[model samples]
Target: MARCETCGNDYDRTFEVHMEGKTHTFDSFECAIYELAPRCAHCSVPIVGHGVQKDDVLFCCNHCATAVGVHELRDRA
Candidate 1:
């Protein structure tokens, strides 16, 4: 059994996620997301999908990017 890195739970069915040259063990997907997902620059929410990015900044959506004076982003095509 491996211990979850996020919740510190020792479980039997834990899984490992490799990202950016690091390995993380989690008991559930929720824990993995909480620990590994990138946060939006404007709202500070974890971006779980194909989020918007401009240079070194990240945003959950185009609206948030635009709200922060990033005018060229769009929500969709």
Candidate 2:
């Protein structure tokens, strides 16, 4: 049984269907699309991931990921 990485819900017959590695799971195709979808740098709309790399850090997205400066979060650890 595959589980949703976000909601941590069991993919049962009540959800949408998708194939991953020969196994089938339920998670609403919309959710899957959202994961793959791009987002705005400032907002959270579907956009794209791009940015500059400093030191050895990587900015997943230029717009959304970089805008939020998630690198700070990564450095807190």
Candidate 3:
């Protein structure tokens, strides 16, 4: 059994996620996402998909990017 890093749960089915040369153990996907997902620069929501990036900042959508003064990003063609 392994211990979850997020909620401190110990379970036999715990899994490991590797990111940026680091390893994270979690009992469920929810905890993993909560710990690993990048937050939007504007609304502070977890980015689960291919989010927009302006310079070094990450935004969950074009609207969020625009809210933070990133006007060149578009959600659709």
Residue 59 accuracy (lDDT) in model 1: 96
Per-residue error for 34 in candidate 3, Å, reads: 0.7
Lowest summed lDDT window (length 10), candidate 2 = 68-77
For TM-score, the strongest prediction is: 1
Candidate 3 lDDT over 1-77, as tens digits, reads 99999999989999999999999999999999899999999999999999999888999999999887899997777
Count of clashes in candidate 1 = 0
- After TM-score superposition, what is the CA distance of residue 14 in candidate 1 from its true location, in Å? 0.2
Worst 10 residues of 3 by lDDT: 68-77
If both were scored by TM-score, which would come out higher, candidate 1 or candidate 2? 1
Candidate 1, residue 59: Cα displacement in angstroms equals 0.4
Please report the TM-score between candidate 1 and the true structure. 0.92
Report every candidate's CA lDDT: 0.94, 0.49, 0.93
Error of 3 at 42 (Å): 0.7
lDDT tens digits by residue: candidate 2, 1-77: 56765456776543444445443333665565566544443555653334334444444444334565554433222
